[model samples]
Target: MKNFPLLIILISLCIACKNAKVIIDDPINFNDQRKNLTLAYLKNRYGIEKDDPTIDPRMIVLHWTVIPTYKKSFEAFDNPTLPDWRPDIKNISGLNVSSQFMVDQNGTIYRLLPETIMARHVIGLNHCAIGIENVGGTKNLPLTKAQLKSNIWLVRYLKEKYEINYLIGHYEYTLFENHPLWLEKDDGYRTKKTDPGTDFMKRVRKAVKDLNFKALPKN
Candidate 1:
């Protein structure tokens, strides 16, 4: 049958497309100033005096950028220093908030920083957590199903590549404050968070149930 070879080719292409990941290398500004700020944050906040601004990545923390579009989201993290509007956090450190990966509403995953590098996304666990931010989490522009799928895929990919033992929503970071993983020195320096809401995290965690990430410490 002449059509047999054509069918096989079609099937192979379908499989490849199905398994293909849509990750883009859209990095933010991580110049010398950012590196120095990160090192300072590590030392002052976590008491880690490392020469490099890298982390072991024992956890993956998920977040949602309240900013609507991918472009705006990118701009928010493009700078190395915290913006003026965030004076509350600027008092602590000048390092801008950033994440390792950001998932667009259409499910396009963008790598903003190196996975092993410390990002100022989460509060206490930035020293050992890789942050994944999803664009659009406002009441009007909630996260989409495409983002959910992309997050699941990213979680699996990171888990396979790193020694990640925990997966948590940004809101869940406070629960680890007393856990051994937390390292922030200033006990009063905590911020409230509800990004990447409970529903989104529940769905993602359900999908990756087989990964068996350690349970979040009881609040």
Candidate 2:
């Protein structure tokens, strides 16, 4: 306890320096171990019957946390229980639910959880969706270009790794509401959400078009 102040100072410095966009070195090393953990999570929470069978990913869900930093975002996902208002999560892993990756304003991407794991980021599609959360989407701290590039790079990387078909933003998740993408058991129940903004998602979608995850245009 005596070194608490020093510990905090050190932590602050480390955080101040953490950046997710360090050239996005090609072959960012998929971390198969982490990927496997994600896969296990998908099965348990979303009831994805098979992993080896080419799991054709149809959508990529995007999000933005009103929360401020990476550590806080990490802490949010690290736990197994979401906020009480998140009734959508209680029926699933009981974990708070987090995205596979989070991009901070500085363009630093942190792998809070594994992609293979079905996170509770989106409703009705946790099993086959990839969730990417941006650090801040609030009025005080809007999205950044660095974060945009990082997202593009990360999306490209994931597309190369998986057989993903559609890329989606959290806001658009509801548009597909009552649609066939609701293959997961949690197809019903819960309210609507719009995250990372429709415009931002459109930009990301354009960047990842090569991956073939684009949804229909907004009406």
lDDT of each: 0.94, 0.68
Candidate 1 per-residue lDDT over residues 91-183, each given as its tens digit: 999999999999999999999999998999999899999999999999999999999999999999999999999999999999997899999
Residues 74-142 of candidate 2 have per-residue lDDT tens digits of 666664545677675466544556676788888887775556645567766776788888988988988
Candidate 2 lDDT for residue 212? 59
Clashing pairs in 1: none
Top TM-score model = 1
Least accurate 10 contiguous residues by lDDT in model 2: 21-30
| Poorly placed runs, candidate 1 (over 4 Å) | 1-13
C-alpha RMSD (angstroms) for model 1: 2.1
Off by over 4 Å in 2: 1-56, 85-93, 184-188, 210-214, 217-219
Per-residue error (Å), model 1, residue 186: 0.7
- TM-scores of the models, in the order given: 0.94, 0.69
